[model samples]
Structures are given as C-alpha cells and as structure tokens.
Target: MNRLTIAAIAVAVLLVTAASSLFTVQQTQQVLITQFGQPIRVIREPGLHAKIPFIQSVIALDRRLLDFEASGEEVILGDQRRLIVDSFTRYRITDPLLYFQTAGVAENGIRGRLASIVSSALRRVLGNEALLNVLSVDRLRIMNEIRDQVNREAKRFGVDVEDVRIRRADLPEENTQAVLSRMQSERERVAREARAEGAEQGARIRAAADRDRTVLLAEATSNADILRGQGEQEAIAISAAAFEKDPDFFRFWRSMQAYREAFSEGGDSRLLLSPDSEFFRYFRELPTVTP
Candidate 1:
C-alpha cells in the first residue's frame, strides 16, 4: 500500500473504533453496559457513555414513563358477581441494573413482569370488594388500592408504578340484562305507586268540589226563601194600605181577582157551593138597570 493510503486507512480505523466505544444517552433513555452478554454497569444520567469497543456492548432502556395494558381478566367479586376488567398501568424503570438482572434489559420482559404484578394485584384487591363498589362511584378508590398494591410488588422488578387504572369494568351480558330487567320492574312499581297516589288525590279533590257545590245550592235556596218571605210581607202591607184607602173598592178588587183566578185555564174545574156564598157576591152585586 502507498504511505498516504496507509495513513488514511489508519485514521479511518481509529474513527470507527471511537464511534463504536462512545454512545449518547438522551434524557429519555438509560444504558446498560454488558460484556460478553452479561451486564456489568448501568449508566443512568443522560450524557455520553463509553464502553470497550467490540468487547463490551451497551443496551439502551427507556427511563421515561412507559405504558402497559394487561389482557382483560374475569374476576369474581365478594357478591359472587363476575366482571371483565381491562386495566392499564404507567411505570418507569428506576433501577436499570436490577432491571437488567431481572429481565435481561428487554422492554418486553419488563412489560411482561409488570403485567403479572398488576394482574395479581388487581385480582387480590378487587376480589374482596363487592360488585356494587366496583361499578359505583367508589370505583376510583378501588383502582387506587390496586395501584398501591401493584407499586409495592413492582418495586422488586426495578419499576416504579406511577398509576394503575381500570379502563373498563363490565358485567357479563346475561348479568347486565338481568340487572336492567330488575331496574325496569322497580321503576314500574314506583310509577304505579305514583299513579295510585294521584288517583286518590283526584278523588279527594272531586269530593271537596261536590261538597262545595252542595253548600252553594243550599245557600242559594235559603236566600231564595228569605226573599220570598219578604215579598209576601210586602204584598200583605200593600193590601192593607189599599184597604185603608177604600174598603169597598178593596173588597171589590179582591173579589174580582178571586173570580178571575177560579175561572182561568189553570183552575177551570167546577166548584160545589151554595149560591148565596160570599164568593158570588161580586156577581150578585151587579148595578141595577133603570128600565
């Protein structure tokens, strides 16, 4: 080889070696130094890290929070009700060395272990709770409990569980239908009670209205009787006044009124009485003719 070509080849070889030895770890990542497939040291702080070129290697792990979701599981609650629980977790690798030792620095391994821990914790914690609590407003409290339990266990795997959440907790289809039917029946019962109460109230109102109507009619009748008595008294006083004005004319007017009434269409029936009866005085007292 030429001397210039030899110098360029040596420089290129050194550059490749240097590049192989140095690796940059960003803020979101961590590195594990492994020699011959065995981890020796873990570099956590974000910066440039060096390893033996071609003899030792580096495995990068995410230091940032990671997400994992376990497959949906069926669990029986304290009330003997079955639920399908789908849960997710947020965690981070706090100890890369421990993680490397436990799961060989693979993200999948970490996720697998986390899934087991979360699943076990979820079952243990939720198994003791009633189904109502699981489906109720206290669901968040149950999730918090599961998170705490999982966090404690995940610490052994060099993980810090940030939070655990249940994405869905659903009853089996048959159970759901049963519950819906029961709820519908309960609502119908309440409706019936309300309708009965309304009918009772309506009856009371109608009875009260009838009583008021009866009272009004009685009062009207009493007022009418009072008016009729007053009218009779006034009529008697008028008759007395006319008698005082002229006794003969008053008597004649009374006789004429009696005769007209007795012979009218309403009282045209014959009467059996003496001809000399005073009722015929008007007829007998006709003015004598002077022929």
Candidate 2:
C-alpha cells in the first residue's frame, strides 16, 4: 500500500473514533449512556464526556428541585368545620437510574406521577381533620403525615419529597353566617341564664332580710308593752300604800293633781272660800282641836 492511502485511512479512523466517543453534560444535569441499547455509563458530573459513536446515545436529566402545587379545595376538619385548603410541595430526583428507567428522558411523567400521589395523600390525610385542626397547630401533624405518605409512594418514581406546605384554609360563604348566628345565640342564652340566676338570688336575700326586720320589730313592740304595764302597776301599788299611810293628805294631793290636769292653758282663775263653812271649820278651830 502507498503511504498516502495509509495516512488517509488512519485519519478517517481517528475522526470516526473522535465523533463516537464525544459527549457533553451540564452542571444541573445527570446523564446515562447506552451502547447497543444497554446502559454502559452513568455520568453525574457536569463536563465533557465521550461515548461510543453511532452505537451509543445519552439521556440527560435535571438534578434540581421542582415544585408541585395543588388547586384550592374544601376539606372538613377534625371539629366538623369546613376548610378551603391550598398547598404546595418541593421535591427532587434522588435516583437517576430509576428516574431514567421510569420516565425515560421525560421528567414530565415523573412530575405527573408525583402530583397524583401527593394530591392523593393530601386528600386522604386532610379528610380526617376539621377546620380548626387545619387552622391551629395540629396542621403541622397533618402536614407531616402527608409528606411522609407521599414520599413513601414517590420513592418508586425516583423522587425525594422535601416538604409540604399549606397556603390557605377558609370557610365557605354560606357557613359563616350560620356559625356567627349560632355563636350569638349561645352567648345570649348564657347571659340570660346568668342574669336570671343573679336576680333570683337577690330576691331570696331581700326576702330573708325583710323577715328578720319584721321579727325584730315585733320583739321590740312586745318588750315596750311589757315595760309600760309593769310601770303602771307599780305606780298604782305605790299610790295605794301612800293613801293607807295618810288618807286625807293623799286625797287632797289626788284632787289637786286632777284639777291641774283638767285645767286649760290660759283661762280665768276663780277662787271661792267661806270661813264659817264646815269645810273650813278645821282651819277655824285649829286651836281647839290641838287643845
């Protein structure tokens, strides 16, 4: 063979080799290369790569996180309240081999699968709770359950779910009015009961006080009557004793007291005396009576 032909053949062989063994990957990507329809290389770094030309091809996939979110929907909480829930999720590809095998150069399929699984988890977990549970600290527990359950199923799809978050929860328009009305009714009923109890207790206390006062007044009146009767009897006994000791003097004093009691405040004072009369004979013959 001539040297020119030998050199030309060698050059052609080198070019074919270069073309078959060359590939590229990005910083956010992982690649799998197949030779004769069999996976022969798994490249996870971002750099230039080489593969068998014509008989080998590469499948590249993103290695970054993606978002999965659900539309707003109503759910019942643990307290029998209605809640509207909106949520979102964050996930990433954890197993490139499974991801490639299952999705095969179409990450959309994995995302779609994850969406279904996560949504189902959310519905199933949230359905057991009430609106108050969703609004309060208990939501953390429910969210954890949802994330764990979704992750359990999503591992089959080559996804590692990072977190689940609820955006909003709300009550339906029709239910708000009913809830408010029920609350008002309950408050009014409680207030009325309290007021009635207070009034009833007040009336009982007043009646008790009145009964005590009546008893006190009756006792006071009876005591006064007893004292007055005792005083009158004592006065009568003293007067009788004095009259027994000095009958004439007692009669004269009694007559003077009666005259004073019967007299008016202001009237003409009249006096009539007869020296020779029998009533004045004691004063006229005082010397003889003494003798």
Candidate 3:
C-alpha cells in the first residue's frame, strides 16, 4: 500500500479506540470497572470517565433509591389470628463494591434476596404483635421495628433499607366468615339484653302507676264518705230544730215527704199497711191550713 493509504487506516484505528475508551456516567448511575470478568473498582461520581479500550469493561448500576414489592405472606399474630400481609420496601445501594460482589452487576439480582430478608423481618416482628396492634396507630411502631431488622440484615448485601411498609393486611377468607358470625351473635346478645331491660322498666313504671291510681281512688272515696256523714249530721240538727218549733207541722211535713217517696214515679214499691196506719194519717185527714 502507499503511505497515504496506510496513514488513513491508522487514523481510523485511533478514532475507533478513542470511542471505545470514553464513557459518560450519568447522575443517577454508578460505574463498576471489571477486568477479564473480575471486579477492579467502583466509580460513583457522575460525568465523563475513561477505561482501557478492549481490556476492561464498565457495568453501570443505579445509585438512586430502589423499590421492591413482596407478595402476600401468611403470618400468625400473638392472638393466634392468621393474616395475609402485603408489604413493600425502599432500599439504596450504599456500597456498590459489596453489592457487585454479592448481588452481581444486575439490579434484579438483589430482588429475591431482599424480599426474603424483608419477609423474615416481618414475621419476627409481627409474630409478637396482636391483630389490633397491626391495624391500629401502633402499626407505625411495628413497621419501624421491621425496617430496622431488615436494614440490619440487608447491610451484608450492600443494601441500606430505608423503610418497610405493609400495603395491606386482611384476615384469611376462612377467618372472615367466622369473625362476622361471631360479631353478629355478639350484637344479637346485646340487643336481647337491652330489650329485657326495657321490658322490666316498662313493667316497673306500670306497676307504680297502678298503685298510685288505687291509692288516689281510695282517698277520694274516704273523703266523699266523710263529707256525706257531716252533711247528714247537719240535716239531722236542722230537722230537730224544726220539730221543736212546731211538732204538728213538722210531723205533717215528714209524713208528706214519706208519701211522695213511697209513690214516686218509676218506683215499684208496694205497701201492705192497714188504711188507718199512722203512715197514712196525713192522707186520711188534711192538716189545718196555715194563714
């Protein structure tokens, strides 16, 4: 070949080599340099970086926080209740070198291991808690405990667990029906008790009212008898006074009142006395007319 053709070929080789040697590290990524399938160093700073053309290779790992979700797991609480718990975790690759050694270069490699760690922590912490604690405000404390435990185990894999949360927690299908039945029975029992108490109160009130009515009627009858006795005594006194003033006239008046009563309309009275009886003295002879 001529010198010009050889020089052109050499320039092309240099350009290809320059392109292979340079790489850009983004703000969200970290680079791991490996030589012949073995790790050498990790680069965390962002911006332009260089490596040997064909001898070394760069594996980029995400430096930002990562999220992982675990499937529903059955856990037994301290109250002996079975619950299906769905949980999620937030983590970060704090030590890239250890992460590369343990989890490999792919981000997906750590998912299985992290999920196992999180589930274990969830069981350990939740096993000591009651169902009420899991569903109440105390759940915050339980989650913190789980996060701390998971974080401790995750550190070995170069992962720092920031938070662990239970997305949902529910009783098993079999337990749900049983719980509902129990609740219904309990409510029925309370209703029955309330009805019994109400009935008892109603009976008591009725009894009190009946007793007061009887007492009031008895008092009224006694008062009426006393007034009648007093009036009869006054009438007797007045009649005695009239008799003293004029015996003949008073006798005639009394006899006339007797006759009217004995022969009053709608009366079925019959007299068996003789015609000359003293009760008929006024009928046989009229009294002298007073002026």
Better of 1 and 2 by lDDT: 1
- Candidate 1 off by > 4 Å: 209-291
- How would the candidate models be sorted by lDDT, starting from the highest? 3, 1, 2
Highest-lDDT candidate? 3
lDDT of 3 by residue, 1-291 (tens): 999999999999999999999999999998989999898998989999899999899998888888999999999898888999999999999988899889887767899899889889988899999999999999999999999999999999998999999999999999999999999999999999999999999999999999999999999999999999999999999989999999988988888889899999999998999989988877788667899
Better of 1 and 3 by lDDT: 3
Please write out the lDDT profile of model 1 over residues 1-291, one tens digit for every residue: 999999999999999999999999988988888899888888878988788999998888888888998889888888788998999999998998888788766678888888888888888988899988987989999999999999998888888999999999888888989999999999999999999999999999999999999999999999999999999999999889989999998888888888788888877588898999989887788766899
Q: lDDT per prediction?
A: 0.89, 0.81, 0.93
Residue 68 error, candidate 1, Å: 1.1
Candidate 2 backbone collisions, by pair: 20-53, 21-50, 21-51, 77-129, 77-130, 77-131, 78-129, 78-130
- Superposed Cα deviation of residue 204, candidate 1 (Å): 2.6
Return whichever of 1 and 2 wins on TM-score: 1
> Pick by TM-score: which candidate is best?
1
